[model samples]
Target: MGVFTFTDEHTSSVPPVRLFKALIVDSHKLIPKLWPQAIKNIDILQGNGGPGTIKQINFVEGSQLGKMKNCVDELNEETFVYKHTMIDLKEKFEFIAYEVKFEPTPDEGSKNKMTSMYYTKGNVELKEEDIEAGKERALGMYKVAEAYLLQNPDAYA
Candidate 1:
């Protein structure tokens, strides 16, 4: 399988604890509220906000983004590190696996370094244009969430 990787970094004025709580713990409820046009809903299929949890993300109808199933693989609250894998990709292209890791920058003011990887099935061909589009969408989603948190500090507390 071919491997594709994407990385993003953002500095948040909010504290790391608050940022992690909002982005990971309450993400299912907060994301749709922040970007209704892109994410219609996030349904938790199993477990709480810990590892082994399963989630289904439903994108808004007619949106370029497609739906996918995610499973939390690792979560380190003390370090604000989170990792998840795409268990299923029914709506989009063929991918054997996908993983995202969020790491808090030490000595930085609530900054986070995020890395994402996608392992595609060997036979499946992924176009560069499609990958670029996905990256843009992901960044857009993060920006929306950041904006929401900036506006409402008490959210997800």
Candidate 2:
């Protein structure tokens, strides 16, 4: 099996706490509504949405990453950080494993950053187009959530 990793990072002006709540806590509910073209639905498959919980995101019909099942690795509201990893790809990823982390930037609510790392499995070399496609979706989700929060102002408060 070949091993490889790729990371994508982005910073947003939306405070960490607010961003964390909307992105990590409420994303399952918001995403499908915001971009029905990108994601169809998100469902919690096991547990109660805490650490060790398992969830699945059902993408739109034409999406390459058709569907993904991920295990919640961490959910730290105090630190404004959330970590989740894909434990079961089900053929969605070119890699054997993938993990994403959303952390408060600079330990302040002024900014937030989201980082995603992918671990390829076996000798399969991941194509940049496929990888970037996933990253774009992730970042697109963030922007949509950010826009929603910006418009609501009091939401996720």
Candidate 3:
């Protein structure tokens, strides 16, 4: 298998803890509500939502990807860091690993960073265009959460 890594950063006017809470702690509940047409729901399959937990994300019908199963590698509320690995992408990829960190800025805002590692099934080389859709979706999700928090200042505070 071959691995390709990509990193992206986003800054938000919202606080780190608040963004973290909305994006990581409450994503299962918030994502589907925000984008009902694309995401059906997120279900916890095993564990108590901590490390080693398994989760399934079900997408709406006719979507490019049907569903995904992931294992939670790390979830730190105080530090605002989350890591998980997708274990069910058996077609083109062996697995995909992601790490997200929300850091507090000097202005009390947030600087969020995301890293994704894609493990291909064989010697296949993955290009930017090959994963552009997933990248856009990930960024869109973050923006949605940011907007939600900005609209509701008291939320996740």
Candidate 4:
């Protein structure tokens, strides 16, 4: 097995707490509402959404990826950190783990950092473009949430 890791960062004008609440805490309810064309809904398969919880993300019809399941490894509300690993993998992958951290910026905004680790089967190597595409999708989700919070200031507050 081989592990390949990548890191990316994004800055948002939304506050850290609000962004965290919208993205990490309330993602199950928010994502589908924000992008119904892509995602159907997020369902909690086990636990109460904290560490060790299992969640399933059901994609909408016509999407390339049908669905995926993930387990929450860690979630710290106070620190604005979340870690999860994809329990279901495609043929070429063993697993994919992700860590997200939201930090407060001096301008009362937020600096969000994301790290992704791809575990491949045997000596299979992942393409840089594939990883970059995934990163872009993640960032797009973040921006969607950020834009929602920006438009509705009282939504996540």
The per-model lDDT (C-alpha) reads: 0.72, 0.73, 0.90, 0.90
- lDDT tens per residue, model 4, 1-157: 9999888988988989999899999999998899887889999999998999999999899877788888999999999999999877888798899999999999999999999999999988798887977887788788788889999999989
> After TM-score superposition, what is the CA distance of residue 84 in candidate 2 from its true location, in Å?
0.9
Ranking by lDDT: 3, 4, 2, 1
For residues 39-144, write the lDDT of model 1, one tens digit per residue: 8999999998688999888999997547878788877777777788777665334543333334445654477676767677655566778777767876776677
Better of 2 and 4 by TM-score: 4
**TM-score for all models, in order of appearance:** 0.81, 0.83, 0.96, 0.97
Lowest summed lDDT window (length 10), candidate 1: 91-100
Worst 10 residues of 4 by lDDT: 132-141
Q: What stretches of model 2 exceed 4 Å from their correct place?
A: 90-109
Q: In angstroms, give how far residue 27 of model 1 lies from its true place.
A: 0.5
User: Clash number for model 3?
Assistant: 0
The global Cα lDDT (0 to 1) of model 4 is 0.90
RMSD of candidate 1 to true structure, Å = 2.7
Model 3 agreement with the true structure over 56-144: per-residue lDDT tens digits: 99999998789989899999999999999989776689999999999999999989999999999887878778789878989988888
lDDT of 3: 0.90
Q: Residue 45's C-alpha lDDT in candidate 3?
A: 95
5-87, model 2: which lDDT tens digit per residue?
66666666567778878888888888889889888999999988889888899988988678988888888878766777876
